[model samples]
Target: MPINKQQVRTALTHVMHPEMEKDLVTLDMIEDLIVQDSFITFTIDLPEKNSQLESHLKEKCEEAIRTYVDEGAVLDVTTAVNISKFRDREDGRGEEQAFPGQGHRKKKKRQKDEGEEELLSGVKNVIAVASGKGGVGKSTVAVNLACGLARTGAKVGLLDTDIYGPSIPTMMDTHERPNITTQKKLIPLKKYGIRFLSMGLLVDPDQAMIWRGPMVTSAVKQFMEEVEWGELDYLVLDLPPGTGDIQLTLVQTVPLTGAVIVSTPQTVALDDARKGVAMFKKVNVPVLGLVENMAYFIPEDRPGKKYHIFGKHGARDLAERIGANFLGEIPLEQAVRESGDAGKPIVLEEGLESRSAQAFVELSNNVIQQLAIRNQSKDPTEKIDIKIRP
Candidate 1:
């Protein structure tokens, strides 16, 4: 059979643009799709021409096409750098250049209330991974999910915004403090191909952030505005436990794409998780879905045994009751904690057919699939919006 253009486009739609966080087809990166019999050729127009992501893109395209087409098909990939898209705006020539003469050129007036306005410089989507209370493994889910997205060729950024206890630096095994650029922007630390910034890096590890609400809010605002996160597809914010000042400030200041509530299968945690969901609803921030972390503990030796140490299906039940998408459940495992301590995410480690890692991978896939569906419209609750009164 002859190669089909629609099939090729459909396959490409599932391939996300690493930097833009959008699909290759949606970003107009995939072009000139020519398929003659078993041979396939296509051009990918990058925003800027560089070797930064050439090999990775080629490999991903080949993998995606092969899944749909014949494995023996000829794949020809070409990339063109469109520098015009990345060029700085040129000053109109023939006009008098602003000189350091008699009257100094008027300074560009900065926006009033710039301090109040929080913006993520180059992130396409800001996802707050939050929990109602602590000990729900919110940070673990955030880190692994960020890694999962990165593994799938998305340029992901993880922000450890838990001021009181910023565990991301330790969890992700990243220790370097962000460097300031000439533009006065803070450059985030990179680890496992994901960019990250954390309060742990900014302050002494032993010292606690003993600041009031206002100070914490200011620090978060600075983190959001001053960080030079260049062209990220998703910026996952690990919010501190509970619905407090920092959470409120983030919702008020940043145009968050949505939130994912992490909770355990315990009544206490579920109670708090519900509050987190209600808080987002009150603030009009969309709750993307619910993640049940530590849903059950499965013994490594006896894979058949699933001990519901916390409780069973608390988060999943809550999600269903509230009409929110139940993203997925992550089993409680020692490897997850060990990985966090070792500064490596379990998602990056070889699972050796381990169920915990498989759970994470499945969770990541579900989140991505939901995100793609959500991106198709503005309403976050378009598919599943359950009205729950606090």
Candidate 2:
């Protein structure tokens, strides 16, 4: 027996939209369905820009097809927004309104309200430091930002949520295992006026984390729910590169005050940074701003001059194009690299003369300014309750 389009469609019938409560096939969300031999690829037209919803559906569809149609089926699933359908609905002439107004919106509101049962209850604000990709010093920016916030006398906590490649321990230079409280909550390690936790601290340094999406999701949730982060003004999360299960799980787990994107002054890096900003927008998370790392370079001997090492203002141009705020630029310097390697971020490295160090100060201030404005102007972000099971 060979697989066919009918079988593929039938298998997908078992896949339901978490919020919609209807089979994808019945909702007619699937399109561009192509089947040949054991290969399958299709597009799922989604209602909005939801990375979590998209990731959840893609994973489930993969499982459903593999179980029902072919154990060896290589399925390629992608999601798209049915813009034409939405346009028709908005114009009041569409035959099918998959997501109608008022009632549908109320249903979503109820879902978000139900998720108000909180995590990180004592933390005043949560900031996620993310990027479009790696090798652009995302973790480095996160470490310094948290340190910078601490420098302002704000109680801060830095969480290294990059589970696969936890860098907070190495960067913060504290490798002692977190002590488990009598109640079993892990106490975060203290350093640089900030409490911090990372998978690096909990596991052997040489060990590799061989995990699937579901397991990673569970561990990330535990990092927030099972940790003792008492009475902090801010908790900065250093997110792993790209949008994946962990990022999706974070939004579902807590109400993030805002997010800060880090990128270098390079075309490839800024392109990924755009996707990062897009992912946050889809999830309804506010992108506080973009920080251009390695914006320029200055040789120690050439204290009177500057050089555009990567490219000039690539990240800044990206921020302007996307209409998001550009926080500031961080110059590449030996001090920044040396400071990170020694587990001390350059932001705390004494000397206002260090341009890289001073850049972090200015970036932190810009973040504070934007945060104050956002808090005053917007409602408290609601914790999202996704109906999908990890």
Q: Write the per-residue lDDT of candidate 1 for residues 1-390, one digit (tens) a residue.
A: 767777788877878878779888886677546665676667676655468687778778888888876677788777655332223223433222211110111111122255643255445567889999897899999999998876655567899888788899889777787666545777677677777999878866344556666667667777778877765667888998998866776666665667899999899999999999998888777788999988898787887888999999999999999999999998888888898899889898765355667888888787776665565545322112222222
lDDT of 2 by residue, 1-390 (tens): 767889999999999988779999998888656666676767776656688998999999999998999999977677765454446566887543222111222233445556573577666678899998897999999999998876665667899988778888889898899766545777677777677999767654344366666666667777788887865667899887887666766665667878999999888888889988888888888889999999998788877888998999899998999999999999988888888889988899777668888999999888878877776566666777654464
**Model 1 — which ten-residue stretch has the worst lDDT?**
100-109
Best by lDDT: 2
| Candidate 2: clashing pairs of residues | none
Point to the candidate with the largest TM-score. Answer: 2
lDDT (C-alpha) at residue 11 in model 2: 96
User: What's each prediction's TM-score?
Assistant: 0.68, 0.69
RMSD of each: 16.1, 20.8
What lDDT does the true structure give each of the candidates? 0.74, 0.79
Runs of candidate 2 exceeding 4 Å displacement: 1-117, 204-208, 387-390
